[model samples]
Target chain A: MTDMYDFFNFILQIRNFVIHLQCSITLIHNNNMIEIKNLSFGYLKGHWVFNDLNLTVEQGGIYGLLGPNGQGKSTLLYLISGLLRPNEGEVTMNGTSTGLRLPSILSKIFIVPEEFTLPAITMKEYCQLNAPFYPKFSFDELSENLKAFGLDTDINMASFSMGQKKKAFLSFALACNTEILLLDEPTNGLDVTGKADFRRFIASHMNDNRTIIISTHQIHDVEKLLDHIIILGKNGLPVIDSPVSLIANKLCFEMIANGATPSQNEIFSKPTFGGNNIVSIRTDESPETEINLEMLYELAAEKPSEIKQILLNN
Target chain B: MRNNITQDKFLWSRLWMHIKREILSNMKQIRWQLALIVGVVLISEILICSNAYDNWKQNDYFYNSAFQDPAQLPILLAMVALGLFIVAIAASMTFSSLRTKAGKINQLMSVGTSAEKFWTRVLIYGVAPALFFLTSVCIIDLIRCVLVDSIMPIKAQFVIINPFIDETRVKAILLFCSFTACVSSFFTTVSVYSPKHAFLKGVCIIIALQTLGSWFLFRYGNILRPWEYHLDLAYWTALGVLTAIAVVLSVVSYIKYKETEL
Candidate 1:
């Protein structure tokens, strides 16, 4: 019986080793794209924006950077894109530290900011002037993009409307063909059709070698497209993970139109239409209920520590 | 290994595409600014030309005394416009989308482009305008001088038409622009730091400095460049110091951008 117990103990130890090994491998590989550890940022001194954040995004797919207003959504994107430096942490890309400017790293990343201005030139002139910076910038692809936008390559972008301008920026960003693309408020001025087109563009363009992080208040614009979602807490670090898997195993989102208090099924509950609460439950399976991003965001925002607990449990 | 393929593009090249589209999409805006700038230049030119023509046509010193040397009129005209464009680009670049130079710096900084690249963009966008305006004023003044000479009996052929520039003056212009642009690049860091009308802030800073400089001059006797603003020597030592300071500040700003989370 003693020998048998030792044999069983050995087997358990081996199993644990394998699991740890796999996790370590995943963690190491995550650094291939972007890596952040113990990151703390704040605009003003002693007033923190985010603190003790740890995150990793592997090469490829789309990351939805979700947060409430005044939360660090755009700030985080800017930090990762090497636009803004973090006050208390390190951000590394492709094994290179971002504290120093590496053209190799910079050339690989492209950011389409919330607001951008184009110069006074024809669309073709714009292309002619800006296409050579990125090694992957495809004139042919840019032309195709222009066609898709119903834009004449020869025409001036100055003639475009706000929506058209945004569309043009999206197309141009895609055309740059960088490995990492950071988009802030990409759907701001776009119409429903334009938004749909953007979804399609994201879906079609996402490649294994490419990673995209889009920051927006409107999570619906990116919910379907994101493979991972990194939700930032005001004055808190981040919890980054695959959205579907997170929703399935860690939390369940459901809308309740008649709840007055904490339902037995709810880990978190918020009011919905006609006095209903969009309640979230701790679950181990995909919730067949509706995906209400607003509610999910509220849960994440209102209870970051709780969300962290859920993440820890997962 | 085959899974994660990445390619690079030149930032300026990519920026140019956006620039082209922007220019195309906002032709009316540009047209308006252009019309305003050009109108101001032409109207000023006409006033000077008319005065000079009257002075020469009258061939009367008593009546022409108000006209003060038609030959020198272009220089005066250029000085007035210099002041105008400075104010204009500041407000235009900051307040409106007309001057996208500061915005581009912020964007470039966000994208992690180097300080060198950032400055290059500014030079093309910011100093390029200044240079263009400088040359234009010189050319316009030279043309005015020719016209004034044709009309006036007082033909002083060697009246420094582009009085603000020369061999020695080029050094000053280069140093001045370098100093100003280094200062202006603060707009990028400031805009990123605050994230509100960053462009406007950049413009305000410049305008405030100019106004302060003028006030200082008015209060005192001589012009005040403010905080080592001038290249006093136009000598190699001063030039070297200016270049080094410009480089350090720009690089420092770029470094500052490295930490700025947009």
Candidate 2:
């Protein structure tokens, strides 16, 4: 009996190993799904929001785009999604220029803007009208997402409160199941419980063949789910690195008592109600800890050169 | 080449889907307004028919002698002409939502090509409303004729003029359609560029065009209307020019739509 159990366990382990290998292969195949090549864009002729910006977002994992107000985080997403044209350079998806907006290419991208107008129709009708455009749209996923948000697909969308409408729109956006999902300020109107559910839903929906880009100034809302964070400076240049690398290489975030003296390695600090939250360069003896995205954003905004050197070296 | 063909097929399918969606949404949005318009027009037509029938019954010989010829029904002609204005208004309303920043973002982010969006608006706002208006008019006229025939003792006959049956009526209809086509296309093009108050802009454009046209005619009327000037040739030339302008405007609208930025 023991020998037979061992053999069955071995067989199960082999099967699991094969499944893991397949997932990795699929991820490798979709690497570098979005490539932004020297993109320059601005709403006006003489002014530019992003100048000669280059970015590559690979498939799989959620990317948190962090920036202060007016840093053009949302604009970058729009340019990538082809909603706005770049003044110079191009954004390509799977080696095809997104400017063309070919039907097949559009089918793979979905964007949930910070502000939008849902037609005066029921959620069901809205989905019926739009779902056909995306070949991979999943009705089951839509139902699940709506239920998670405490919404019903049959409700009239026009009657929904702002938060409820955002929830409904986000549900539909995720249900589209496009390979690339661009979300701008997705957690803006969500309540506490709703925000938690939003994060959970995004985490559950992630797959090896998909990429999700979320742009928001509210860093804490999405900090936990982000595998990589791209912080855009006021000048539009971005410092892209993984949260793990950021914590391990350059900074160690800590909460000390208010009025504590600054340490030699302290890079930045901000006083909080209970304590002084601090960002300092990681020393040989300093242990790695959670990254405070808010501090990082503030530090990067104030001294982009210093942060850029650290991030680039890593 | 094979890949190009496949891409084109995909785009066409998506365009058809977009057109159907726009048609359904527009119908839902304007159904009540359309019903109200039809009701008002039908009631007015009924009253007019009733008065005409009463006059005919009072003096059958005089009515027959004065206006019994089978010319195009003036009321129908007038209604068709009014329908063109309605079409222009509808065309201007097509992209009214684009006036708002939120609405513009929603539209640009939606999964459809610029060509698909442009053509869908053209069909829904420019073509479909005109056809609907004409159909409503015909139905109202038929009801009017029935009521007049049944209520009058003199049995007044209201001849429903079919434009296709007579050459002159056909030409008049062709000219009217050409004019409507030009006006509707112009409004559609205006809607693409004027993000806010597109209808107002369209009205201003129409006023400007009319003023220019009047000035031209006033200045060159004598020179163009000499004894040898053929009116038919003038009409045809006008039609050709208007059609050319409409085509050019539509192409410009498409190009502008394709290059639109949020």
The per-model lDDT (C-alpha) reads 0.63, 0.77
The alpha-carbon root-mean-square deviation between model 1 and the true structure, to one decimal in Å, is 12.6
Cα RMSD of predicted structure 2: 10.5
Worst 10 residues of 1 chain A by lDDT: A278-287
lDDT tens digits, residue span A1-314, model 2: 99997888788568546644654564467677888989888888868899899888987878999887898988888888887888899998877677767665677888898888777778888888888877778999999999989997777777999999999999999998899999999999999999999999999999988899999977888988888888887658885445555655678898899667776788888888888888888887988878788888888877778877776664
lDDT of 1 at A45: 86
Which stretches of model 2 miss by more than 4 angstroms? A1-30, A239-244, A258-262, B1-12, B24-27, B50-74, B153-160, B226-228
Worst 10 residues of 2 chain B by lDDT: B1-10
Model 1, position B153, has a per-residue lDDT of: 57
In candidate 1, which residue ranges exceed 4 Å CA deviation? Answer: A1-31, A99-101, A120-122, A139-155, A239-243, A250-295, A301-307, B1-106, B109-113, B125-156, B161-262
Candidate that scores best on lDDT: 2
lDDT of 1: 0.63
